[model samples]
Target: MFPLFLWTALLGSAALEGPESRLLCTSPDLSISYSFCGGISHMLSLGVKSCLTKDNTKDDLYLFFVPKRDIIELSVAIQVWFKAVQVAKFTEPLCRGFDDEYSFCGVLKGETINITVPFSYRKFIFPQGQYTVLFEGISGRSNDLIFCVNATVILK
Candidate 1:
């Protein structure tokens, strides 16, 4: 019958393909682990989850948070491989809502916001290794600690 013929074709093609023909690939189930660095855990939650992308070459970070206080300016320190480095420090303005790149910029205090940040590793040929990143934030005006997130990423 035609039904049996169609089924054979479908199964035959699927078995022929390899991992490179991945239709849907995802990382292992992961949880947001606690870090020794300080953070406003009362209102922020961070996690790493595999998200589908066009190229299927990168992973993303998911953040759901509510700000406890008004934030105008932000300072960030990103440490790779769990080591401190001066070059990884930077400062940027918060709440640039007009820019489409930051759709969650206009969030108000007590309002919940969820956003995804992607890590694309295809452009640069990264060496095979286990990499971990630590992101620490401080309030620009008060110079007080706000949040710290540490995550490990594996690249193949």
Candidate 2:
């Protein structure tokens, strides 16, 4: 039989799957509007949870945006920091494997861009704790900042 605390944690994890956990972007610039809908899932259990699991976690990031200008190119950076120390970082072209309709590699003014990136966490092992996840989008041409979403995630 599971302990009371373990049962409670399991119940709490179930509650997280129902819409309690969501990505909230803070202090977004006025030039663009952004939003995301997705969650992290344990690779072994395949359960969608609010927190991230150690090596072998998967992140389904469904992000959308409305650009005010013609965006020639874009890049994304996802970093995990624990206690102000950089633990892991992933950076790559924003629309590498996505289809053209969901790619933001080249966008036009007033066009809406929707992208879904499935991130595989197979490199680093995060200890059980809370960490900050920073998701950033930037202009690939001029290296200008586009937007950033800073949110917290637990690693269990």
Candidate 3:
């Protein structure tokens, strides 16, 4: 559960828009739900079935989803991989401070978790290549995996 103060701060922002496309994961952990928003219009979607459409607008990407209701003790992690090479890793603490134009202020709405990735963020810059984003919800007590999302994105 998030503190009341944090929740209030997050909800102060405008509600997130939807995504233009959905990137499907190979075998998503069903305990959690995910959403993605991007482009200038901030189109939103429940999930990405494949690669996102090519866009050079350098718009920010928003990730929002709900976690399991029963799990109050867990930490989240975001990882970026390019051609199987890990390029970036974000822990919960790091994400909390990554609120510049390059990232979102980690926010919680009800059971939903929200995060943003600004185009100016170094990790979002692809060298005219493809990449994968992994979002994980991990158990805090036993250090076990709770939920995971693997989405592919291409930069052109």
Predicted candidate 3 versus true structure: per-residue lDDT over 1-156, tens digit per residue = 556754553343113323323433322211222333222223222433232333323335555555433243556788776664568888672222333232222333235555555543334334755665666666555555545544555554
The 10 consecutive residues of candidate 1 with the worst lDDT sum are 16-25
Return the candidate ranking by lDDT, descending. 1, 2, 3
lDDT for 47 in candidate 2 is 19
Q: How much does each candidate deviate from the true structure in C-alpha RMSD?
A: 18.2, 14.2, 14.9
- Models 1 onward score TM values of 0.55, 0.53, 0.41
The C-alpha stretches of model 1 lying farther than 4 A from their native spots are 1-36, 47-55, 82-101
Residue by residue across 1-156, what tens digits does model 2's lDDT show?
A: 556765675355345444434443222210111223223221001113233334335656555566654566667788766665668789877543335344565677667666665766567555756676666666766776566554565543
Error of 3 at 27 (Å): 25
lDDT of 1 by residue, 19-127 (tens): 2221122344222233324535557765556543335657786778787654554556665541222223355555432452465554556878788888765675544
Q: Comparing candidate 2 with candidate 3, which one achieves the higher TM-score?
A: 2
Candidate 2: which pairs clash?
Answer: none
lDDT of 2: 0.52
Q: What is the lDDT of residue 148 in candidate 3?
A: 56
